[model samples]
Target: MTKTIRTNPLFELYIENNILVINNGEDLKNNGHIKTADIESIEFIRELNFWNKILEVTFGLIVSVKSEYVRIRFKDGFKDLLVTNCDRKKVEYLVYDVNLLILKTQNHHY
Candidate 1:
């Protein structure tokens, strides 16, 4: 089964076919994926300042929010961004699980 975490309409996360995909699953231009074996680390950054956070938390109830970003660093020195706009705690928990899934996928293949 495919696992998914929706942070943004465009910046969604998926774990399927031994890959970590970051996209809305339809936007070809935004569709980016890193092989489970190639992921070096996944780090989250919050850019939502007080005003931005207020805007995001309140406005997000009716609109899209773009405040957090998950930076996926690859072993080959390349990197990708997964912009998120959800609750900080939820995103943190989900990313932590993503890290675990990455390790699990790598171990399974080995």
Candidate 2:
């Protein structure tokens, strides 16, 4: 059975049969199947805002290619999933782990 891998208040991410599933609030929103053979690379980016090196806060994670554009809520505010005001380390780790799994699955197919 497919199980949820990660979730925030506004989104749920699931991994099943090497495919990534995203749900919004109470329903399925988008789905992407991993084409391990076609994927050239994966990247995870942490978004931050800095001014005069005075304040820096991590907001979101941006994934190359497949997850380039996504919107998610951060705290009580809404922002692009790639540009949020949520916990940075946590989101980064989650995306990294998911990418690893995708790569592992690709390797297994060969």
Question: Which residue pairs show backbone clashes in model 1?
Answer: none
lDDT of 1 by residue, 63-96 (tens): 3344566677676675545455445565566568
How many clashing residue pairs, candidate 2? 0
Once fitted onto the true fold, the runs of candidate 2 whose alpha carbons sit more than 4 angstroms away are: 1-9, 26-42, 50-80
Worst 10 residues of 2 by lDDT: 64-73
**Which ranges in model 1 have alpha carbons more than 4 Å from their true place?**
1-11, 25-28, 48-66, 82-84, 87-90, 105-110
True-structure RMSD for candidate 1: 6.1
Error of 1 at 10 (Å): 5.2
> RMSD in angstroms, all models?
6.1, 9.7
For all predicted structures, in order, the TM-scores are 0.57, 0.45
